[model samples]
Target: MTAPRTGDQRLAGRTALVTGGGSGLGAVLTHALADTGARVVAVGRDEAALERTAAARPGAVLARQCDVSDPDSVAQLAGSLADEHIDILVNNAGVPGPVAPLTEVEPQDWDDVFAVNVRGVYLMCRTFAPGMTARSDGDILNIASVSGKRPLAGRTPYCASKAAVLGLTTTLAAELGPQGVRVNSLSPGPVDSARMRRNFTMEAERTGVTYEEAERRFVSRALLERMVTEEEVAEAAVAMIGLTGLCAADLDLSAGMVAR
Candidate 1:
C-alpha cells in the first residue's frame, strides 16, 4: 500500500509498541504510526538509538530498551506497561545472521539468530497476547521477509528463522482469532538503507562489478525492478494494523521479489 501524502488520525487513541524502533525500517515505522495519531512505544536494546527515534516526536513516541530474545527482559517490559493497553504489536526487531553455507554455520550464530527472530516473537506473544485477548481487541504484525518463502543460499540460518516466523504467525492467528485478536505477517524485499548499501558494496567486490552494476543485477530478479522503499513498507504495516478480520495472512511488500 502507498503511504498517504498527508497524515490523519485514523489510529487516534490507540497505543502501538514497535520493537527495533530505533533504526532502519523500524525508525520509519515509528514515525508512520505516530503520524497516524497513535502513541508509539519505540522498543530496542540500543538506548541511544531509541532516544533518537523518540526525539522526532517527543510527545508521541516513548523509547524503551529491552532485549526481545530474553524472556526476563520482556517480562519486565510487560510488567511496566501493565497499566497501559497496547492496541498493536509490531515485532520488527531482527538480526541478519552470518552469511555462510549451512555446513559451515556456527552453533552460536544459529542460536543467536533464532533467539532474536523466533524466540523473541514467542516471548512477546506470550507476554502480550493474553492481555490482548482479555480486552478482546488487538493486532499483531510480524516483520518477516520474502526470503522466508524460499531458500536463501549462504543465509540458511536467517532463512530458517524467518520460515519459523511464518509458521508461528499462522498458528498464533488461529489461536488468537477466536478471541477477537488478529495476527498477520508482512514480508518486504531488500530495503534501500545504509546496511544494504554495505551489502551492495560487498557484492560489487565479490562479483568484480561496479556498485551500481551490482545493485542493478540485484534488483533484476524482482518484477518491480527495484528494491523496496522504507515508506512503502511502513505504509503496508500501517494498513495491516487497521485490518479487522485478516489473520494469518501475509502482506507481501517485496516488490514482487518472490513472484519473480
Candidate 2:
C-alpha cells in the first residue's frame, strides 16, 4: 500500500473561516484552502452561492450565511461553532463606495460600507481572538485594498474603512503577538471581481466612456499593465496564512502597484 500524495498539505488538520466566501475572491480562496487540505467554513449572506461553493467541495466545505457588519449575527455564528475551533480566518467581505466626493456622499452609504468592511472585521476579531489565543497558533488575514494606503479620488468612505483596517491589523498584531496569534492583512490591487466591474461601470458612466475604456484606464495605472486575477489574490491569502511568525503587520500583494 502507498500513502496518498496530497497537495499543499500545509493546512491539513486546520479549520478556516472565510467571510464573503460565496463569490469573487472569497470563492476562489475557499477552493484554495480546501485543496490545501483545510476544512473551510464559507460565510456570506448569499445562501445560493454559499451552497454552490460548499457543494463543489463536498466534505471539506460548509456553508454558513453571515453578515459580518451585524454584531448579533456574528455572535450567533460564533455560538453555533463553539464546539469547533478555527485556525485560520479571512475577513474578505467588503464593498466599494458609490464614487462621489466626500461632501456629496450620503451618510447611509458611508455607514453601510463601514458596517461591513470595518465593523465586521472588528466584530469577528473580538468574537474569535480569544479562541485563537487559547490555541496559541492561529492566523487572521484581513482583506484590505490599495485604497487603504493611498487616498483615492471620490471614495471617501471606502478609503477611510480600508485605512482603518490597516491600522487595526497593525494594532491587533501587536496586542495578540504574545498570545501566539498572527494577524496580518493583504491589500490587493484591482482584481476582476463583480464589485470591481460595477465600480468600473460607475466610473465609465461618470467619465462619459465605455466600461472597457474605464478598465483600460485602471489597468494603465498598474505597473503590470493588466488586471489582477482573483486566483492570484486567493493564492496570496493562502500563502500569507501559511507563513510563520506573521504577526502585527500587513502584506501588500498589489503586484508593485503600491509602495511600502
Please report the candidate that would top TM-score against the real structure. Answer: 2
Which consecutive 10 residues in model 2 have the weakest lDDT in total? 2-11
Q: Model 1, range 1-86, lDDT digits (tens) per residue?
A: 98754323457778999999999999999999998889999999999999999999889999989999998899989888977798
- What TM-score, over all chains together, does every model reach? 0.93, 0.94
| Off by more than 4 A, model 1 | 1-10, 202-210
On residues 35-81, what C-alpha lDDT tens digit does candidate 2 reach at each position? 88899999999999999999999999999998999988999899888
Q: What is the lDDT of candidate 1?
A: 0.88
In model 2, which runs have C-alpha deviations exceeding 4 angstroms? 1-7
Model 2's alpha-carbon lDDT is 0.87
- Give Cα-based local distance difference scores for all models: 0.88, 0.87
Cα lDDT, model 2, residue 157: 96
